[model samples]
Target: MLSIDYQQLLAPIQQFLQCETPVTWLDVAQQPAQLPILLTDHLICELKAAQSAMYLIRRYAVDEQSGEALLQWLKPYEDFTYRQQGDWRALADIKLKKSMIPKADSGFGQELIDKMVLLIKEELHHFYQVLEVMQQYKVPYDKISSSRYAKGLLRHVSTFEPNALVDKLICGAYIEARSCERFAKLAPLLPADIGAFYLSLLRSEARHYQDYLQLAEQIAGDAISERVAFFGKVEAELINAADTDFKFHSGQPLAFSAAVGA
Candidate 1:
């Protein structure tokens, strides 16, 4: 089994997230008192984002028609969390599969499948945990605008066949890596309870990033370092640049004082 040098990557990951954490988020994160609330929101975003990738795989990258099924699988959780149309007890009963994609003779397929399945499972579990925390803290759920981070990086994808797929997978790698990095950066700044939770996520999150990278390599069958660097630059731009949205992955603060000021 292939393994990632998680400890080795920690420093770089930390640097990426902390580099441009926008002065805007500092105040919110510094409020150790509100760490629980902020972290709860962060966790939900992570799960939903991961679920999106799962659907992408089940839809475009995998069996092609499994996309609708993937949506159905996530519908309950989405309705409960985002739409508020379902109950928590209903979510507890939801049993999404660990691996919707199967293994193949190439070894590449199975490796990607297994790793991503673990990621989706962990992400969904994290979502549930966030809801639990929110319920305990009496925090109300609200819809936040989509972050520019993912879209910015994704825009660089080549409009071709396997090249597009390869680029998308590479973009996935950066997203996962950046998320792991952000969690590490924010952990120490958070309250003890939330900090512990963030630290706990470091292990699996780091592995998830590596998993995406490996999948990119397996599919491309060549040196993806240039491609990786290409997306890294794009991703860094999205993070280092200014933005109006306030999200877990949003860039510079847009002065939307309404959300923070409120």
Candidate 2:
């Protein structure tokens, strides 16, 4: 593995977001007792990230055939994550074909397909990596509810055309950036191999956020600084607010604090 000056890598990411991962959340996240839920949520987060990318491509960029192909490509992993019905060992060989047909004459279609295909590939690979780590840690697979974090950001999306797509892309940027930030914060606090794996993800995660932002700008065809800042505030508020649920992307854990007090 290559050496990283994490401080150097994370500086811009830190500057982009409105706030940091709360120390209180980190305190609970690193506990041994919290590992099960954390790993489970982390695993699902990877899957959801891939699904989000796939959905974006299918809805806005690809033809119907390509869209169906995308869904089929993702099905096995979805089965494993959602139904626990497949072998994790076999996922490494799963690959998205290179010849996806783009929607006819759409300006952003090809670009969206290019960027999102790569994101979907990386995210699915990460889904497998997390599952491998879970197996090593003896964390059994179990379904868990998503945290309010994503919904909180998405609920604000404009219910109009290109605005809706642009908003979704902006929200994707925040989600990736926040994931990268939390991974950096929690990596050193975890056990060695897992810490290294999380650290290994920094570059791609950072790039994923940038990719989403660039796509957002391209789709909107104007300066999105105002909208980006708008989401920065929404994302920060979500991160800062207290929550009973504790997932990988959860806000501060009120439930954990209450347990400790009791």
Candidate 3:
């Protein structure tokens, strides 16, 4: 069981989320057979999170050449995750040098670069950690279709420039907050070691959500409560409604009733 208080850990997340994760999802999550899929999705989610942050920085904060360098920095991990071309060990010595990107002229640009770079670093580290845990459990990595949860929220983003950026940040905040909330919920239910690992991730995940929210506010320079509320409702719908697929962030499983009937 987790040593920390879940309510305290999840307070901010709960406030941000419009709804809680359904019990049906939790029931499916507790099944032993679900471990492989759960962990695999988790590993992928970490890498994807890093990739998203990198893209945000590269597109808005860095110059063209620097953007290419950022791609090069991420190539190996992407290759490994997508094609299984290299082992996770190859990622150990890789370092993101400061010279890869030029200094930002605007305060907003500098802040985005700084925060997103740190986020990428931490996410990749967490990806490595998830891979290690999968190795320990003999869980093989296989590509799986992404859950609808993210896409559902992303579909609501405005196509306009600053609005698009603000919306993406808001979406990021929701994703991170949901991740933290789920980690707190699942930690105590898992085995001791795994539970401890999940608990350990709570602080970083919470901070990540906060970082995204702060960036959104900074970029908007005005009250973003309306947009935030919009995404919250979308996120809550994705969580509360029935989902055909089971993934790390998927909603209530449609298979639940079938399993019960069987």
Candidate 4:
């Protein structure tokens, strides 16, 4: 029972950004044979996204309530990943975090923290959903190497205080935006259930990107246009470049037949 009216949510998000996701993302969705691998990568990426949010919460958001809420929100995924409790009966009552990060010390910290926590919750929920789907489809889980996408984007950080944080936030915006864009592009290609689930994510994912961009702007208190432009080029290159791994966030497909072929 997906609650999203995807077309309504995605139109504004795509319009707000200066970019559109590449079409190839949907192409992957159409190849159901590849879904197992794609979803495995997707599951890991979701947890990684959640971890990024948790790090921000721990580092900047000083509220104990927010921390507890985060822990509670992530309980299902954490239980499954660490404690191996992903049985069907164990996933019924998953709840999102209740606390919001405060905008006191630095709006940047609180704002990003709030958005990221929600994003993480959704991503992990999505992860759980994907795992369920995988189990139904008989896709076995395996630990795989990460793609160069995140690493490539992270390499551009300024190696200093606010600048580094700013850069990271900007990168986050691109990642979330790209994800939203990809969801929009791919949802229709999937089967009814999975398609509905992906479409359901559009609203939150779009808002998450906007939240990241807004935080980047507020954190700088000045024109981040240049920084955005700088990262735009970098992100575009990473998206367009050649890559061997097939990850949720991997670069342009390498045309190599094998899923993990390096």
RMSD, one per candidate, in order = 4.8, 1.8, 1.7, 4.4
Question: What tens-digit string does per-residue lDDT give for candidate 1 at 92-139?
Answer: 667754335542433455565566666777887788777776776677
TM-score of 4: 0.79
Ranking of models by TM-score: 2, 3, 1, 4
Model 3 weakest 10-residue run by lDDT? 98-107
Per-candidate TM-scores read 0.81, 0.96, 0.95, 0.79
Q: What is the lDDT of candidate 1?
A: 0.67
Tens-digit per-residue lDDT, 52-101, candidate 2: 99999999988898998999899999998888898989999998764777
Q: RMSD to the native, candidate 2?
A: 1.8
**CA lDDT of each prediction against the hidden true structure:** 0.67, 0.90, 0.87, 0.71
Q: For residues 2-71, write the lDDT of model 4, one tens digit per residue.
A: 2357666666656545555545544554687778777777777777778777766766664777777777
Query: Which segments of candidate 1 are over 4 A away from where they belong?
Result: 1-9, 12-24, 32-37, 64-69, 97-107, 254-262
Candidate achieving higher TM-score, 3 or 4: 3
Candidate 2 at 240: error in angstroms?
0.6
At residue 30, candidate 3 shows an lDDT of: 72
TM-score of 2: 0.96
Full ranking by lDDT: 2, 3, 4, 1
Badly placed stretches (over 4 Å) of model 3 are 1-6, 100-105
Worst 10 residues of 2 by lDDT: 1-10
